[model samples]
Every structure is written in structure tokens, then in C-alpha cells.
Target chain A: MNKGLLIVLSGPSGVGKGTVCSVLRSKMPNLTYSVSATTRPPRQGEVDGVNYFFKTREQFQEMIARDALLEHAEYVDNYYGTPRDFVDRTLASGKDIILEIEVQGALKVKEKFPQGVFIFLMPPSLDELKQRITGRGTEEQHVIDHRMSVAAEEISLIRYYDYAVVNDEIDAACKRIESIIIAEHCRKDRFMSELADMLPASEKV
Target chain B: MNKGLLIVLSGPSGVGKGTVCSVLRSKMPNLTYSVSATTRPPRQGEVDGVNYFFKTREQFQEMIARDALLEHAEYVDNYYGTPRDFVDRTLASGKDIILEIEVQGALKVKEKFPQGVFIFLMPPSLDELKQRITGRGTEEQHVIDHRMSVAAEEISLIRYYDYAVVNDEIDAACKRIESIIIAEHCRKDRFMSELADMLPASEKV
Candidate 1:
């Protein structure tokens, strides 16, 4: 059986990356969303392994020391990371894995696994992103400003990604992301290796 | 407006490339199928521009001399070539362009236009290709053998292509090609420039 592809997605905070991932997961059943292990306490209605793999700070540091995490980050006094084992197992079982990470983590993963497909999501515009952030009404003005500043740094790194999808419209962005996945699977290297075993000796010429 | 992409398609004979192209065209309305200029006589029901841009030997040679064609070939006492003007105009107008050419011509286009997306369509397996070739019932046994040999040589060059779609099922192959085209449009370079313009200054922080 052909192994599944590893996809790494990164973007600014309010680029609708989560929505794209959710829509894609709904459309594709064989996709496995890589859950990160976090050292932070679970929020209301959150479950272990479902929402996140809640790990102690010591455990998180241990995983980092052992190089067991594909990528990890410490944000807002909480440590979070993607477990390498789960992703590897999912891919080994022919299930595509998606890692929604930040630019730093994505760059690290790219360095470790050069073959992984990296996708960067972009908001329709900075103005639109500000609107979305303000519309959410969840963050204070100062926090929104901080996010906006961070977005500029992230946008500058867009050139490093293998592909980019602009989240101007949810459905269109989701479809475009899905198409990218399909196109990557149709890559020549992947197809030739898969076709090798299917060719008959007589037909090999 | 940003321009659409130019995709160059090539495959071994009897690989169901024509059928796949036809199906893909039906599904993608914005796709412009490039018409080649040829010195060959038009068959019954063939129209100029639609079937081919039939040209006199002198005209075809003049085009070759002027470098008017993207790629050209001489076969069966006739000259055939893809006109560059129409393809360029179509892509510039934000419509995708498709060029159905042989492997040699495909490589030439790739060398000339490095940004052109190259796709190679292959049969699911050599045995399956033989079955399809025999299924056509128009070729002699010797001709089939000749095609099989050529196919082997063509398969060896698959490494050069950006993508490959196995023509196991006509609809599936077409969908895959269509998806690749759509996905290519969402490339980060194209989106970043456009998105940068739409961003508001306030949101840049």
C-alpha cells in the first residue's frame, strides 16, 4: 500500500487556517489531524488525546530532549508540540497527516523532513484579517495589535512555503487546499514508484 | 488581473492522454486547448483553427525560422507545431492553456518556459496499456509491439515531469488534472502579491 503524505500548514494567527483544515477533514475521511501535546491545562469540555495530549512540563521537555517531537513551541507560558510517533503511525497506515503549526515550527519540520509538503495560508488582506479579529470580540485591543504585528513577520516568510492558499472565501480556499493535496499525490516520483509493481513483465518491453 | 497558468502535457502513445485531455477540457471551461499549425492535409470534417491551423509547407517553415511556434516536429511527411501567440494571449487573459504534445516537444517547452507546468499521463500499468491498445482494434500486432517499445523509452523520462496521472479511470484522471490546474493557481507567489495589496495599513501594525 502507498504511504500517506505528510502536509505541514502554517500562517498568521487569523488567516482562517483552522476553518480550511476543518472543511478539508470533513471532505476527506482518511486524513489524520496531528494533535499537539501541550503542557497547559485543558480548557472547559476539552479531553485528553481528543483536544490535546496534556503533558507535564517535565514530560514536554523530555520529549524535546529526546527529539521525539516533530515540532514544538512555548507560547503564553505553555509548551506545545506534535508527537512524531502518532504522525508516523498515521502515515504508515496510509492516512494523510496535517500539522497546523506556526511559521517557526513549520520551518523546523521542513528542515527535519524535507519531503513534507508545506502550505502557507494567507488572509484576504491585512484589513480583512483585522476585521475578522475584531469581529471575534474575544481579544482585547492590545492583544489584537500584538497579533497584527506578528502577522507581518509571518507574511514575510511566505516564500519558504511550497504552496499558498488565500482564505478570501472559505469554500474556495478549502477546495484549493484539497486540490493541492490531490495534485501533490499525482507527482511523478510518487506515481512511478506506485506503478512499478503493477507493470507486467511482458508489457515491460 | 493575475494571469492563468500554462500546462504542458505529454505521454507515451496509447496511454489514453487524448481521452484524458478531452475529459479534462469538458470539466474546466476556462481551459483553452491549443491548436497546432501543421502542413498535413486536413481530414474529413476537420476545420481550420478548430482541428488545426493548416498551413502550407512554406508557411510552416517560415514559422520555424521566425521562432513563432513553441515546439514543432516533423513526422509522416508533415510538419506540426504549436502556435505561441494564441497560447500566450489565452494565459494572459487569465484563462488556463493546455498543450497536448509529445515528450520531446514537452521538454522543449519546459526548457523555453521554465514556469510551465509539465504533466505526464501514464497507463496504470504496461499490461493495462497493452489491453487498451488492443481494445482500440485499429492497430496491427507489429504496431502494438512498436508502441510498447516506445512507451518503455518514454517511461524512463518520467522523472523530468512535475506531475503524473495514471489513466486507470478516465474520469478520475481528468479530475486529478483539473485539480492540479486549480491548485497551481493558488500558488503562494501569486497570492502573496495580491494579498499584500489588499492588506490595510492599520492591520500591518
Candidate 2:
């Protein structure tokens, strides 16, 4: 079986990446959402190995030292990371896996998994981004302003991404992501090996 | 308006590129087939501008000398070429254009239009290719052998293409092409400028 694609979706904090990813999961049943490992305590209703692989500080640090995490970043004094072996096994099983991550973590992941389809989920407009952040109404004005600035910086790094989908509408964004997956499968570099077998031995290049 | 894509489809003669392209045109109404200029006499029911921009020998020679053809080739004592102005005008007008050409002509077109999406259509297998060509029953043994050798050589050149589509079924090939187009639109380089406008002036890169 052909190895499945590793789709990495990332964007600024308040760009609706989560909502788009959640909707995309239901549409693509074959897709497996990668469960991240974190040192942060699980919230109520969050399950270990399902929502996250909750780890102690020492365990997280050991994983980092052992180079077992694909990428790791500290947030609010808590460590979060992807397990390198989990992603490898999923892909080796020919199951498509998706990682919805922060822009920094996505870039970090790319360092090791350069083959992953790195997609930047872009906001429709700055005004829209600001409104989305404000609409959350969970944070103070200072927190919102900080996020907006971080979003702006993260968006400027889109040049490093393979594809950019404007999150103007969640469904539309999901559809475009689906098309990208289909198109990536058609890319010559990825599909060339299959065609190589078709070429007659004498004519093979 | 975003500049439309220049899609170039080519394959061995018996690989069903024409049939797939025709079906694709019906599905994608905005896609315009680039009408070629030819020195071959208009066949019965063939229109001048719609079917081909029919040209005389002297006119074809003048066009070649003037570099007015995007790509040209001589076949069966007849000259067939793509008009540079026509393709450029159509693309400038923001209409996606498709070109169905031979492998050699497609490569020539790429030398000038490297931005074009080059797709190499493939037969499912050598047996399938032989059957398709033999089914026509219009050639002698020598002609059939010559065509098969040529097809084998053309298949090897797939390394130069951006996508290698197996024309195992016409509709499947068309759908893959549609996905490629959608994915191309999402490519970071093509869509980045649009995102630039959304960035705050201070954050523009």
C-alpha cells in the first residue's frame, strides 16, 4: 500500500484553524487526527491518549532529551510536543494523518518531516482576524492585541508554506484542503515511482 | 483578476489524451482550448478560427521566422503550431487555457512557458497501449511497431512533466486534472500576493 500523506495545518492563534480542522475530520473519515503529548494537565472531559498523552515534566523532558518528540514548544510553563514514533507508525500503516498545530510547531515539524504538506490557514482580512480574536471575548484587550501581533508575524512566514487557504468560510477552507491532498497525490515526484514500473525496461529512464 | 493557468496535456498517441481533454472541457466551461495554427488543409466541417487558424505554406514560414509560434512541428508534410499572440492574449484576459499536443510539442511549449502545468498521460500498461493502437487497425505491422517504440520513448520523458496521470479511465484522469488546477490555485507563490494586501502596511514583506 502507498504510504499516506502527512498533512500539517497551522496558522495564527485566532485564525479558525481549529474549527476548520474539526469540520474537515468529519468529512474525511479516513483521516486520523494526531494526538499530541503535553505536560499540561488534562482539562475535564479530555482523555489521555485521545485528547493528549499527558506527561509529567520529567517525562516530557526525557522525551525531549531522547529526541523522541518530533517537535516541542513550551507554552505557559507547560511543554507540548508530537511523538515522532506515533506519526511514523501511522504513515507506515498507510493511514493519512493530520496535525493541527501552532505556526511555530508546524515549522519545527517541517524540519524533521519536510515531506509533510505544510498548509498555512490564512485569515480573510486583518479586520476579520481582529474580530475573531475579539469575538472570543475570553481574553483581555492586552491578550487579544498580543495574539493579533503574533498572527501578523506568523502570516508573514507563509512564504515557507506549500499552500495557503484563506479561512473565509470553514467549509470552503476544508474543501480546498481536500483538493490540495488530491493534487499532492498527483504530483509527479510522489507518483513517479508507480509510473516507473510501467515503463518498459529498455526504455526506462 | 488572478492570472489563469496554462495547462498543457500530452501523452503517447494511444493514451486517450484527446478524449479525456474533450470530456474535461465539457465539465469545466471556463477552460478554453488553445486553437492551433496549421498548414494542413481544413478537413470537412472544420472551421477556420474555431477549429484551427488555417495558414498557407508561406504564411507558416513567415510566422516561424517571426517567432510568432509558441511551439511548432512538421508532421506528414503539414505544419502545426500554437500562435504565441493567441495564447498570451487569452491568458492576459484571465481565462484558463488547455493545450493538447504531442510530447515533443509539449516540451517545446514548456521551454517558452515553463509556468504551464505539464501533465503526461500514461496508459495503464504496455498491453493496454498495444491494444488501443491495434484497435484502430489503420496501420501496417511496421507502422505499428514504429508507433510502439515511439510511445515507449515518450513515456520515458515523463520525468520532465509535473504530473503523470494514468489514463486508466477517462473520467478519473479528468477529475485528477481538476484537482491539480484547484491545488495549483492554492500554491503559496500564486496566492501570496493576494495575502499581502490583507497584511497591515507595517507587516508587509
TM-score, cand. 1 vs. native: 0.92
lDDT of 2 by residue, B1-205 (tens): 7898899999999999889988998999889899999999999999999999999999999999999998999989999999989898888998889999999999999999999999888898978999999999888889989999999999888888998777888888898888888888889999877877878887886
User: Candidate 2: lDDT of A3?
Assistant: 85
Q: How accurately is candidate 2 docked according to DockQ?
A: 0.76
lDDT by residue (A131-201, candidate 2, tens digit) is: 98899789899998898888898898898899999888888899899888888887888876776787778
Candidate 1 on B1-205: residue-level lDDT in tens? 8887889888988887787788877788778899999999999999999989999999999998998998889999999999988888898898889998888889888877878889998878788888988899999999999988878778777778999887778988888898898888877766656755655554331
- Flag regions of model 2 displaced more than 4 Å: none
Supply the global lDDT for candidate 1: 0.85
- Give the per-residue lDDT digits (tens) of candidate 1, residues A1-205: 8788999988988788787888888887777899989999999999999889999999999999999998888889999888998888998998889998888899998887788889988887778888988899999999999988788778877778888887888888888878898998998777766656654454332
Per-residue error (Å), model 1, residue A94: 1.9
Q: Which candidate is the best by TM-score?
A: 2
* RMSD in order of candidates: 2.9, 1.8
